[model samples]
Target: MTESAEVECVVVGAGAVGLAVARALARAGREVVVLERAGAIGTGISARNSEVIHGGIYYPGGSLKARLCVEGRRMLYTYLDRHGLPHRRCGKLIVANDAAQEAELTRLAERGRANGVEGLTFLTSAEARALEPALRCTSALSSPETGILDAHGFMLSLQGEIEDAGGAIALGSPLIRAEASGRGFALHVGGAAPMRLNARVLVNSAGLSAPAVAARTEGLAPEHVPQAHYAKGNYFSLTGAAPFSRLIYPIPEAAGLGVHLTLDLGGQARFGPDVEWIDPLSTDEIDYAVDARRGDGFYAAIRSYWPALPDGALQPAYAGVRPKLGGPAAASDFVISGPEAHGLAGLVNLFGIESPGLTASLAIADEVAARLSEAA
Candidate 1:
């Protein structure tokens, strides 16, 4: 027989989004318990990626990605300021490599406007070169609100808020199974000390594993769970001093935002995240290795926008896999499934939370809280 405990809410996964959700509920006076399979928090999808604070561009108008990113970016800056977290509004430039690509820049600016992003400025190649002397482009769109932050520090702050409000984050604890209980959920937990938890709510913010978790849960209708796909991106760190003062991006690609230059808080420049679709039945089959041979492709892509890129300057740094709902041919939007969508009361599932996920975390948390409240 499994030991049992009770809580107002049980959140699976301790990624950035999970922590944000936990903090939001705890602040609302709910007794929340966050379960993480890893020994430490943020070891999964949250730990990887570009860590760019998006400026509400690059998403369809009125979509959750656009709305939540715009709202979340503002909330994140405010939260970081109030807490003195490590972040910088260093800005970003979306460049079109040649005159043939100039129309895409115009469309991006128009899209940004539709998405309510502020301060989007169009620039000629010469004008863009003025901002970042080494930048090469036919035209560029400057997004002053786009930036970078210390992702780890941000997660720590969310964890701090959750704990301060009496919420517990149980690392090394995984949700083995979950089923709908009377007006809530019954969760079977796995860890050093296995037990069952009865809670008023269940939130699956498991990031990459969310789809799998939802498929296993007893009450969730299988048809409600979306198919899972992975798009792995590889990053290569620049070997020398940074070439540009701000983040630099080429025109977007079908599978991702494209191979771009992102600067860390310490000002080190790394270019990469070229899209490579991964096909694996289990998460264990996914490999995060940054293949050096892939650097040949990076050199070519990076040189297209920055001709000054020297040969052999690209070094394999890292790789991150984006949890996607669809494949390269068909992109998917952020899926936030509440009781309204699945008819499962007190349960919310988040899927395809990649890219702007770090930027949209707070707003996502707010949306999750609102959904749960409506069910209440």
Candidate 2:
């Protein structure tokens, strides 16, 4: 498609969120196109971190991540099942090591219940320990809804739906700029055959690049754009299975959950995501190599919950960046700027869609579609 031509929708950034928007649009009978800066989809946050499906337990009640995560967690399992996507509802345990931490676990269960999380229950330390003999805790909350999935494969499934529905995803087509055209907008896409595309609606799901894309989109105000921060978190893998059968997590930190335990399809375990504020952001730097020395703190925390954890067992696995809405000392809810928020026509900007983003992709897409449909 060229600048002179027009489609129903043009989705920028082909990560999980972008692909989900494309899939939803195609399913809704719209001719959509996805422009990706990477050679393939899910190269950004989608590929790097743990594939844990969040159970919407952490956010404040009625928050976007909380609501969508709860709804999305349920929707995701269905999508995975219907499409034969690889996943397992391995469940999860939020452990509290002592009296003080036990209060935190109670707070989490209450928040989960207030956020409409189903099947959440409190367990005594002994109950928790029995479930995973290696686990030691003063108390715990069991979330049966959480699990992991093949994230890349999930994106592929969304891409397949977009293609099968007569939509196209222009790989390597980085969004250079966009201009306001007639009632729609014109997009300058960067790629092998650099070209332009016109669309009636635009959805910026550009993950890390979201702020820049919104600033570049036609008829958008730069001041309205919030500064994007790259909050980097590192992960460490266990050479063998984690003694715990379910995913285990510490209470959430300011920007993310504390170093938590997550498993893969193979049931191998990894823990991590220590937060660090980044200055000059560069997502391409794939420092998958992690430092084993950091395990000292992890050992301290894990030992608080599982004291018998053998020393020198946790190895550095990988790390990923979170596109955050807040910096230190702040915890901001996600920003999903639609036409009303920005006063633009037929556009939606997804900002601060970090942690639970993978779990909330489908529901978030449906929301973006509903918002855009009203504007369109």
Best by lDDT: 1
State the weakest 10-residue window (summed lDDT) of model 2. 280-289
> Candidate 2 on 165-216: residue-level lDDT in tens?
9999888889889886557788887777777777888888999889888888
- Candidate 2: C-alpha RMSD after superposition: 1.8
Q: Would you estimate the TM-scores of all the predictions? A: 0.98, 0.96
In angstroms, the error of model 2 at 50 is: 1.0
Query: What lDDT would candidate 1 get against the real structure?
Result: 0.91
Q: What TM-score does candidate 1 reach?
A: 0.98
Q: State the number of backbone clashes in model 1.
A: 0
Q: How far is 92's C-alpha from truth in model 1 (Å)? A: 0.7
What digit string (tens of lDDT, one per residue) describes model 1 on residues 144-187?
Answer: 99989999999999999999999999998988899886668889
- Least lDDT summed over 10 consecutive residues: which range in candidate 1? 97-106
